[model samples]
Target: MSRGLLRSTAVFSAMTLLSRIAGFARDTLQATLFGTGGAMSAFIVAYRIPNFLRRVFAEGSMSMAFVPVLNEIRERGDKAALKDFVDHMAGALCAVVLVVCGLGVLLAPAIASVFTPGWALDQPDKFAWTTQMLRITFPYLLFISMMSLAASVLNSFGKFALPAFTPVLHNLTLIAAMLWLAPQFDIRPFGLAWGVLIAGALQLVLLWPALGRLGLRPRLRAGFHHPEVRKVAKLMLPTLFSSSVAQVNLLVGTVFASLLVDGSQDWLYYSDRLIEFPLGLFGVAIGTVILPHLSRRHAATDAVGYSGALDWGLRLALLAGIPAALGLFLLAEPITATVYNYGKFEAFDSRMTAISLTLMSLGIPAFMLSKVLSPAFFARQDTKTPMRAALLTVAANVLLTIAFTTPLWLYKVEGAHGGIALATALAGIFNAWLLWRYLRRAGLLQPQPGWGRFSLQLFAACVVMATIVVGLRLWIGSWTEIAQPTHRIFWLFVVIGAGALSYAATLLASGLRPRDLRH
Candidate 1:
């Protein structure tokens, strides 16, 4: 890898690590305060609806369409054309996001009714809290969408550190709110919602200085009719459908989870959060840094560069993802207990959540690989193919959910959360496979030599990590009479540290080196 790409990846990875840590703190706070109950479920539902929209409009569709085109314009056009295109797109996106958010705020109750009807029926107070929280946080969707646009521009300009680190600001703000401000208001969970809005504003403000540094001062322009703007709109439509399908499937799962039991949504939410920590840290950071580089290489017809970038991304994904999946699977119980076994979160809740976490870990690699691979299509501007794949994945997820849930419901499984986790994992694997096949068929992705060796080494590392982690957990379990939380946390760290050291030693012994991570 070039020093520039490595530097960018490292910077982004560090920032992502901090953000994920803060996110864990935030989740820990939520788990303690709300536990596996109606309030937590309502909060998850409220937060998810807008977040789902953010993914569709802001993170997924908009960035995928805007970044490559912006890069192309920057390469071909003058400063004036670039500024005009950004201004027009920004204004148009702001208008659309504002309108949608307005509708969301106004119809928060009704929207909540449809997606989380069980909450509305059984826990009126929880439903009301969710409605109000949604009203406050809905506007964050608009601000963050604009932030996504600005960040994409900066990233295309190769100024990745600022945009990548800006998320840390959001996480910090939420952590502060949860620790300090929320208690002052007696609406602890609601305070987190307010923190989200403030964080979005902060993220946008942070990027504005970066935009100015890039000689781009965005101003509202009546240029929706601009041809370039229209092109972005045209590209975004299919991508939106593609992106929203995944969100829709998740929302459907949430609905089913709501009906399952009181704490089911919370269990699923916590488990998903655990898996998402690594996914966000490595998968998202790598994807963000790799996309523009891949797009540029594809645009320049640099086949070797494109292939190298893909290879490095896949290799890095395996290096980071496989160990994470194994660690989560083996230490799910201890990790959950150590992080979240407090306040209203009891032993039973931790056990249930650990079960879900273990099941979800099985799909971590598949999920990360999908994140890494989908960009191959996006870089080539072939959104239609991924859209088809995404739709098919959603259908498969729905069918699998029904299939799995039926048996679990019939047998009254101890933690019925396993079915949801399994369904999601199966769907994710399907999604990854379809994307890989499509990219290969389109000639956008090619298999590299030594993949067999990479797989073998990775498998060996996972085996070593899993064996140590499981043995350590068994040893710790035998000493359950340890009275202090400090003792528990200390032993947890010892086991985790030893397992990590073993994995690292095994990887090094197998001939994988830090240099292999470079492009």
Candidate 2:
């Protein structure tokens, strides 16, 4: 089981790394074409609305509800029953998502107003532009939700690679749009919106053959009365909030950010893109790969296996997340300047974005740990506990966003967006704590032996990596000051390579081994 878990995690992480690279390219083009300006801020708000719902339903809520149930059916080895349940879920999800998409399009203006009240009041044109872009992007919800359902089914059957690779398609599509399509459009960002809509259909289409190859192709028939359908629906209710709490927190941050300054939303958005690299590459991949194993352990009533899986997940999260957070924090400025300082994304924009990225990087462990911890509850079919934790998280986020940002905005602090990022980081810590407390109290998990030594070794490695990165940064100076992209790229890779090598050497000297990851 441990070997299989490690293999699956490697597969998912490799595919996710490809997707993140493509995502970075897409973002770089986006920054070059449309910098941190009023239009970009509006586009961020517009894009985030549908993207939030995508996370809420497809990535977060539905998958958490669907995967465990499907795992159970697969474990029973009842192929026909599994197919029936999948078809019913397809019908139900399709019916519901279609209606939601329609409403989203029709209500685009109203939704934009609610999400970006300050923009609406202060800059009606930007607000209007957001509504237009949002309408075009809304239908992405319907198609991508179906794709997510398909991906979840594939994941249950141990077919992880195809689904994990699907985002590469989306990123490539957006990059193409930025390069060619955006230039043709009157409003260039609208090309990005169109790209989103087109990519959604393409992703769903790509999944069809994969599902058919597995003999799990979903047939469309209303299964509103199906027992499994009802179970998923019941689970999805609480899992909605619980699984998507981070996105909800980001959305809440969007609300606060809209009122801050002209480019505040764009600054926050760029920082978020940088932070998502580590989160997507390792944090989310770990969560995705662990869910099915955890579910199997829970279904078989193997408490020891379940506890072991959770422990393994937590350990990996720390191992991957600690160095990543430290590296990002230490190299925030260079990364932002190299990746995004172009066209209108000037030196000041890079500096502002780095501030937020630095603060958010401080929460990487908290964020990644929460990813693994929440699934521990979901795999047990216990959504209510996570739902409660999610509520506390959101509340803390809202209150802290207000608490931290108010004084900054009141005192006219430049880059108040950094305060919002700090609030989010703090809230993530609180959320992770609550999740660990509840899980420990319920006896769902217990820390395995060697955790103390493991933690010390990981922390020591991170400290080494941070020292190396900071020293390299001081020696190389600002990426923004570099005249040529080739020079910037070369030095950036060098810094990253030096930091990675030092960290690996530290781990080796501390007696960490490759096989230890399997344990």
Candidate 3:
């Protein structure tokens, strides 16, 4: 970790913190307005349809393929060539995304039926609502995909903070819409869906001035025939399949959960939102900064630089992610109760969400590790490897979901939410393992002497943090009742703050310092 890397990480982490805070506010509004019910389930289903595509075509494959190539051209060619590449890719992406989104709108019913059959069978009205919402929000995928491309350009140029902070605006827009517009529309969740569109537009608009500042004026042009455009298209095909497989796993979980009970899908969605807060803040922000840096190092054939970058990323992820995971696991009930026990949400709902949160916390490291390791392959232009790993993970997810859910369904378990959580955890571990193995086999990760010391320190810190969190929870167990949201809220902060202090003190005692991060 050089000073430059540490500085970049700090900026990214700060932006991610803001984004996560706004995201929490957005989730709070949604939970209060719809609770864990059909409306919320429908909204999750509808929103996920476009979101899946956005990740696949926009942020996932496109960024993976486009950024490195852009960096290469910018390194070797002149400014005019880089500008030409951006304009061509932008036009090509728009045409492709528009056609795909239009098809998604036309086939919403069929798509929704396949992904969420239980909604179609048991709640036809909800199914129709989801279809309509999907139509309204699907175009957002197009705009945001373009936005992601623009952000990738800015990021590769070492201009990261603005693009990284863009999600804060997205979340703020949704929060405002939920607060102000939901009441005006008698349709409840429709306003939230409208907010999704507005947020996507805002995200795009917010990036343009930044692009101008970078001296790149992207225009819609017929650059589809450019050789570089074709090269990107060639890489994108397998990458798209890989991205779709990951999204399909989520749809599978949603469909399976929907079949189990009325609110199962919503419960899982809310719990996922909680886990995503840290995932976005730490895993995604780190991954965003690491990729371009790794790409440049790999291009320069600096194996030591690449390995050091990966090491620092993994270390920082463990530093923040481990304590957060432990805290979430220990205070799941209190945290859920505090954040979501309002309006239509009730005590039992909090318990269910807490169970899901605990399970998700167990998988947080796997999720973060996958984010850190996958960049190695992406930097090397090997999307197919991750695609293979993703396929295996999805298959494992389906198998584990069936195995866990069937036994619970037969035995009449009191809380089947745990089974979904366990299945997802297992799947995530499998995904992370495969990613690590592939990266090692490809000669991406070199053995470093300090890695063992770093791992030991991280494990020790996690243990100390978990012990403190559990001890504090036991000490305050009587005060934090799931039925009393206010009490739970009070204890939630106390327990978390105490645990965080304990972890930080332990890390400092273990000889880890801010200066140690500077390689």
Best by lDDT: 2
Candidate 2 local lDDT, 1-519, one digit each (tens): 778888988899899899999998998888887987676787788889999999877989999988898988888989999999999999999999999999999999899989999988989999999999999999999999999999988887788899999999999999988888888988788888889999999999998778998888999889899998899899889988789887888999999998988888998898988888889888998899889889998999999999998999999898888888888888888899889888877889889999999998888999999999998998988899999999999999999999999999999899899989998888888999999999999988888889888878888998898888888899988788897877888999999999999999999999999898888
The candidates, ranked best first by lDDT, are 2, 1, 3
Q: lDDT, candidate 1, residue 376?
A: 79
What's the ranking of the predictions by TM-score, best on top? Answer: 2, 3, 1
Per-residue error for 234 in candidate 2, Å, reads 0.6
Compute the lDDT of residue 252 as modeled in candidate 1.
70
lDDT of 1 by residue, 124-147 (tens): 888898898889889999889988
CA displacement after TM-score superposition, residue 371 of candidate 2 (Å)? 1.2
Candidate 3 TM-score, true structure as reference? 0.96
Candidate 3: segments with Cα more than 4 A from true spot: 241-246, 410-412, 478-487
The root-mean-square deviation over C-alpha atoms between each candidate and the true structure, in angstroms, is 2.0, 1.0, 1.8
- Span of 10 residues, lowest total lDDT, candidate 2: 36-45
The TM-scores of all predictions, comma-separated, are 0.95, 0.99, 0.96
Point to the candidate with the largest TM-score. Answer: 2
